[model samples]
Target: MNKEILRLPLYTLIAGFILGIINLITIRILIRGTNEWTLEMGKTVFYIELILSIIAFVFIGILLRQKYNRTDFFKSATLLVIYSAVVFILEQIMQYWGFYSMINSYLYLPVSIFTVITSLVARISNLEHIKWLHVIPSIFAPYLFLLFSKNPSENTAK
Candidate 1:
């Protein structure tokens, strides 16, 4: 579905925002408390993050699948690489700056491989990996996080 000018990076922004807020809020929680989720909880979060990251890539594929048909392998390769770099940088920032905990180590251990898989699978899944599949995780993770987080009371950061 080649649509005119439905920018994939826009989806990236949306996905980044999802991941960014997760970084912010989770970091805030860690800063307030221990920043260490239980192994069970951490695994849960990792799975969730993996899901989100994958969705992000898959969505990018879906969104720009049409435009992608025209795009070349080098362009696709560049975009995949860019996605990896962005994931890494965000993970680093989330680890140190926002969350700022050894909990970062926990998040990182699982996610590095997760991100790699996200890159590979999404790239293959997409006729044009730059559009729909690439960006969907960004859109999904936030809402899912909100849905699942155990709020004794809703902490609306409004």
Candidate 2:
């Protein structure tokens, strides 16, 4: 397997983890006057996270467009799954540290599901066919979850 094939997903995982930490810190600093982290604050941070993830996906897609090659489906799927799992684990750690008390699911489940789909599609499709359309599901996932979920407050972190 070409090491290059692994670069985009790995870079995305590392970047997302770092950016998530930075986002939590920045939000905490900005909301220092508040006695407790509110749902609104959590939503703000999550929205920012969603945007960051989208940006990362687009950047990676563009960066690798010319260079991306079709690899073994299982290998590509495994790498993407690992990327999703690591991201979810890191976010859980952040939540455990009290950074995501007001958030539920932290966009992990939906994002992971959509990410794997988007990545697999991109990986298997012709380079020319990999476009912004591939990311629409991911982009809508958070909003869709929020719209369809039962009381968001009930699902807040313990």
Candidate 3:
């Protein structure tokens, strides 16, 4: 049995969980106030942090591909799902602890999706003949851009 199969996905899962932890901690500190002024600031900080995370995923995913020679698309997607699930579970647990609210928590789902898609694309790009397949991931880049472009409502930004 090839070790790369287990290694890549496991590493991705761990990295995803770590990043999610960082995200929660950063947001907690940045969003200190409950009023409108602080709310707006939180929204900006959230988007900025999300973008930075996405960028980090892109680079890390690409590096993983180079190191492990990952080519299976399903494996890549599954790895991302693992990461997303870990973050979601952590967020839910935190909410239950009264550290964060449940309102608009689903918004974090996109971060996981976009990060995986971006990383998958980066990996697929390395293939020799499937030149067009590499472009599919770029489509999701607009979604990432749109995330930053929209004005998050106070109610949904939580």
Candidate 3 TM-score over all chains jointly: 0.41
TM-score of each: 0.40, 0.48, 0.41
Of 2 and 3, which scores higher on TM-score?
2
**Candidate with best lDDT:** 2
Tell me the deviation in Å of residue 100 in model 3: 14
Q: Write one digit per residue (lDDT tens) for candidate 2, span 1-158.
A: 66765655555556556666777687978699878878788657656655766665566555554444333223443566554556556656876798865343444432442554555456567565656566544444322222222343443432
Using alpha carbons, what is the TM-score of model 2?
A: 0.48
Number of the predicted model whose TM-score against the real structure is largest: 2
Residue 25 in model 2: lDDT: 87
Off by over 4 Å in 3: 33-39, 78-158
Cα displacement (Å) at residue 141, model 1: 19
Pairs that collide, model 3: none
Superposed by TM-score, candidate 2 places the C-alpha of residue 152 at a distance from the truth, in angstroms, of: 44
Model 3 lowest lDDT segment of ten = 142-151
